[model samples]
Target: MDSQSRVFAAILTESGREYTGNENPQRLKVQAVDRQILNNRVQEVQVTGTAEDCCPADRVSVRVSVGHSKDSVNEVTNSVSRRLEYILQVVRQHGASEKDTSVRRFLHREADKYHMDAEVLITFSDFEKMERVRSVLLEKLAKSVCVGTPQFYHSAECLSLMRRRACVSAVENAQQKACEVSQLLGQTLGHPFLVREEETREWKNEDEEDGGRCQNATRLPHPSQIPTITVSSQVSVSFTFRDISKKKPQ
Candidate 1:
């Protein structure tokens, strides 16, 4: 071939590889790399939030005890039995079933005189009923019956509800924070891409430990004063970023 013809042929051969099928695999590889880079550019925001709340007790228990001393064993036994029976009858009449009541009795000699002591523990779901039973026993029996103060506590259902409330509150706080941050960044907040409960804690109100001036304790928070349980939760949430222009009209 002539020199000019040879130069033109060399140029054609050098540029031909780009259109040939042999370069297809390399082109596909470059496109795959570009897709990976685009995936890495996807925007997301992560935030953490925490919340705490208190739950009131739902059940109460009361204890009643009676004791008597006499010169003879028969006298002490009869006296104690009569009072014990009366107490049990009063408890049963106040909406308390056999399953809700427990009884214990003791008979012994102290200083040559026979002595007897009996106790009844009653569980009440209705606070009104518990108060009524306590009042009646103290009124009719006078100093002969000793009625203890009410002890309040939370039931399983109450505890479950409290836990759910705390967790949901934490999640809501996180979502609110994410929305505000997204607005500041000129982006719209999108649906949550990931949600996780990072931690949870629970404790009883301890006013006594803090010199009786804690926030949850204006007064002494004993079992008789409707003690409260505090529950706290922390959550981490990740949300995808959306375009502000694409946000729905409000």
Candidate 2:
């Protein structure tokens, strides 16, 4: 091989290293540049930061029941069926779809008297729409109707969005902390070089449901304060800093 072709070439190692050999060796080998490059990429200040917030539940479920009594099972059942149909129509008018509603029927007979009931489970994405539907059901069904308190919870999409927002806040917190630390160390803050999410946590009010206790309810459930969802995030960020004092004199 030509001596000129033996020119030094760069190589990588687990840890950056420097090689200083003969002034002009016949075969020149280049090394240690990677360590310098890696050092340039590595950040100087490391910080662990966290952020948390609570988001109100936006999804709701309302269960309604209609019941009737008559001399025959079929008669009472037909009566409840008519009321349920009316309730469904009212729900559709308020923007609910068939896919969002579930219907179930019940029957009992005793000494020529028949009792029948039908319940509808309606899922609503908007509270205003639910309020409208509830009003119509109460006005139309009157004595035979009962409306339950809306069950509040978070949807998958809502949870995902909240989690992302929490992570972003956590990163911001880490940067802020790093900036303060760099200032205390007499350094100028630079852009973050690396970020590692150490943990993500979720918390809920002990008095409220956390998407685990779900039940098919009937009759009116007394209203209480709405539940809340909280998501928190922890992140470790490596922030770059510059030594302002090290700048070359003018």
TM-score of 1: 0.67
Each candidate's lDDT (Cα)? 0.71, 0.70
Model 1 lDDT tens row, 1-250: 0000000000012322223233433343222223333334556677888888787777877778889999999999999999989999988888799998999989989998999988888888887888888878878988887787666778888888988988888888888777877777556778887888888889886432322111211122345457688888888888887644334768
| TM-score, every prediction | 0.67, 0.67
lDDT of 2 at 12: 33
